[model samples]
Target: MEKVRQATDSTVEMPPATGRWKLIGPGIVAAATGVGAGDLVATLIAGSRFGYALLWAAVIGCIVKIALAEGSARYHLATGSTMLDGWRSLGRWTSWYFGTYIILWGFVYGATAMSATALPLAALFPILPLWAWAMISGLACALFVALNRYEMFENVMKFFIGLMFVIVAGVALLVGPNLGEAVQGLIPSIPEGSAIYTLGLIGGVGGTITMASYGYWVNAKGWRNPAWMGIMRLDNRVAYVVTGIFVIAMLIIGAELLYTAQIALSSGDRGLLDLDAVLEQRFGPFVSKLFLVGFFATSVSSILGVWHGVSLLFADFVRNHIKGETGISREGLETTPAFRFYLFWLTIPPMILLYFGRPFLLVIIYGALGAFFMPFLAITLIWLLNSSRVPAQWRSGWLSNGLLAIAALLFIVLCINEVIGLLG
Candidate 1:
């Protein structure tokens, strides 16, 4: 492999060309990161309430994410710059917004993610309390990320994803989904009073801030040039395909298990625990325990994914904005002060929230900030990829533009709904 100098003058080692199947790492990580326990719960709730009516929304959600992820990855390979770099190029305000958002979001998300991951662990082994397991989970994920690099992280995520796929999808199948109704779900129709849930399913499917991290993962995987575009596309496609399947499986469970029974689960991670009890009653302890283990895998994988991916974004922000670096380089990110600082920021400080509960004001702000991130991502990608900033050959085509526009509109509506909900 020869070193290729990007437009930013950063030297990236060009990885050897491999078959499409072999180029499927970052996407897997992205998929695993995006589909957490909350997503499953949301999908499950949608299925349980609306049956398969919103199944189209989940599939559309996957398609929208494919566009977002593809655009992010394409920008990195096209310009040899990170997404932060592109944002920086847009204006200083973008930098300011992201810097503030990352700090606040990570502070809150750290506690939430740790708690979610700890739920299944506590259920499986009730020796420890939830907060204790949360602290341990946080420490374990941070240590694993801090100790290893991209390859190990990706491999471990893949294993977790595979485990989740088998368990969740298997459970969905075991529930004996109504195939005819599920196929009907393919048509775009929203039952009355189902608007919010429909939008949520569409917008929330396998999406998170981790979608922005897709580019950083691409670079970490050593795919830094335009030549890897095809591979990136293939990788992105496979990621969402897997995501679609996982989400559909959850919908199946929700539809068959909960909807048919007219059982309503509570909101949040606790709902998953509630589901576990239901499973135990319906299918016995073994199947219920298997679902809990799968839940652990799903939740823990997100913790690890964010621990690694968002840390990279923070590292890039520091490198470009503070350290005066021109381009992103992988050498220092895993070991750099900024990287470790944010990693520590994500791990340690939030433990307080785990014990005492999140501050009300901070929760509000976090909610407002998070509500707008998807729209922010969608709008920015449209501006960056369609403009002269990206190379002419790599600029977004009509399909990309249309999909992104739809995503932006969808997220904007969702953001407004979020604000209204918060205010109400």
Candidate 2:
């Protein structure tokens, strides 16, 4: 580990990362991970319910993700510290909070992601049951991430993300055009009786705590200075903007194709299967198959992303905190107590959740913690980057701060809504 200079000197003296395209690593992976099946379903529901009226919400979601992600990355570049390190600096309690939250979150999320990836496969080929396919997905992702080659993992993630973009965007085109109405959606408006979908669309669009894991991606890319900061922001904006467009395309398909249909989507992973039935009925077997393929791409991208990225975060947390080391050594990150521990944390315990299914209490806890994370990240970024720890050049600008403030309030509202939803 390089000696961590004082935060002040670290900001000024760090070597700038060379090359243009090379700096895009973590932001792309984070964007891929953040845009999952749930995000797609929320956009779909919004489009189906409100036509293009809720398109603005998708844009809001993208903007918020960029802000939060940029903040996280900024904290890392400025201080030469991971977000976990930044959190620990705030207090030992912050570390405990994150540790406990991540463990619980991983157990619940791993099952959810595996089942999500499985549902599409099961829908495509019903010879095997859903749980069996889910196990295969879990094992596959675990084995792949366990390989521990960062470049190889990023390439694989980019491939799946590309497939998801093509199929989902292709389907949107096949559904045909209503550019006049689509353009109108660019204007913000809440239609009658569509408040819930609007809220969901706004809140769910490509937003996830996994976005926080982007900094690790940046660090992995060897970007470690204020000079790399501009590239980082640009990479972040471009990624989430792609994420926004993908979501908007999905929403357009849902609005144009399914608005008049009387079908209802089941909540959770079942919803995608329900959507497959609709596709099969409306289009044909080929369309249904395509939808399932796209579903698998989206779900598996998320599974692989979280499996790899969050485990990296968990591992780094251990190396930094428990071991009293600096960032994971190049070799140590691949083979360390922290890395292997979170690999199991992500892969093993979650299989049990698959067998038992998601308990109501577990679901509630997941939702509660998940809802609170964006606000927490936003708040912490504001605290860390705006303080003496960050150089003025690396700090968030006024516009960025304004956006983060809005994001913080939006997440606070989401947390309240989640709590109320859980209680009900």
Candidate 3:
């Protein structure tokens, strides 16, 4: 295999052709990271309010994410640059924007992710207070990621994904989904007042910034050149296919069980707990407990995924911008002080927020930043993949461009709506 010199002053050897399907770690990590408790609640809400009405939205959401992830991976493999590196090449302003957004985003999201992970553990045990569980969850994930290297982290994520799939899919089956209605859901139609829900389902199926982290994860998995492109595509497909199934299963449960019962869940992560109560009442304690365990898996996996993946991004940002590093080297990033600093940033300070609660202004800023990220990502991806930034063969084709454009428009509208809601 030929080796190419990357900006990081390292040689990237083209991976040998083998069973590409076997190289599937990063996609699983991204998939697990994307489907948090919030996604489950959103799908449940959609199903309960308009049974199978927004199912097409979920499918489309997976497709959109697949394109985004693929573009990110393609950029890294083609140019030997991280997403942060690509953004930096766009301009220093891009670097400043991302650097600022990620810091603020991480502060607020740490608390949010920790709390979400804590909820199910608290429900299952009833021994620890929510705050305590939240702290423990944060510390536990921090230690796990801090201790393990990429391979170990990937394996752990795979276990969580499998556990979540079996439990959630099992519950959906137990709920007895109406197959005919599910099939009909493939046709697009928005019931009255379902426009926002439909859009949210389409735009918010799996993740936000985590989509960008897909490249970092792929890099961490040692896939460095265009030779890995086919494997990367397969990995991405399998990831979202799992994501689609997990989401569809939740919608089925909501459509069959909650929609039929006319029971509406409360908003936020609490809504998942409400589903647990309903599940216990409808089935038994065992099923409800099983669902909560799956919920815990989903939330904790996000914590772990973000802790590992985004930390890599942060480390890369610091390397390219702060340290004046031109190339992205895996060993350099993994061992850098910046990586450890961001890992600590993700873990410790957020625990203080867990105790004191996120302040009002910080939450507002976080919400605003979070709202625009998907649009920012989409537009930048279109620019990066289509421009001379990437090689001709590696550049996005018309179909990829079309999907990404549609994704950009969808997210821009969603960003506008979110901003309006925040201001309102």
- Expressed as tens digits, the lDDT of each residue in 26-70 for candidate 1 is 998997898888988999999999999999999999999999999
* TM-score of candidate 1 to 2 decimals: 0.96
**Candidate 2: clashing pairs of residues:** none
2 versus 3: better lDDT goes to: 3
Task: Kindly report which residue stretches of model 1 are placed more than 4 angstroms away from their true locations once superposed.
Answer: 1-18, 328-330
Give each model's whole-structure lDDT: 0.89, 0.79, 0.87
Residue 289 in model 3: shift from native, Å?
0.8
Q: Is candidate 2 or candidate 3 better by TM-score?
A: 3
lDDT of 2 by residue, 1-424 (tens): 1323323334344444566665566777899898888877777777777788888888888887888898888887777677876676677776776777888899998888888899889877899999899999989888888875788888888888889898889888988858999889989898898776776677676677688889888777667665677888888988988888799888888788776564567776677777788878878999889988989999998998888778878887777666666543333465666777787777788989888878988888887877778788888888777776666677778988898888888778878888898889
- Range of the 10 consecutive residues with the lowest summed lDDT in candidate 1: 1-10
Ordering by lDDT: 1, 3, 2
- What number of clashing residue pairs does each candidate have, in the order they appear? 0, 0, 2
Per-prediction TM-score, please? 0.96, 0.93, 0.96
> How does model 1 fare in lDDT?
0.89
Please tell me which model should have the higher TM-score, number 1 or number 2. Answer: 1
Query: Runs in model 2 with CA error above 4 Å?
Result: 1-19, 324-331
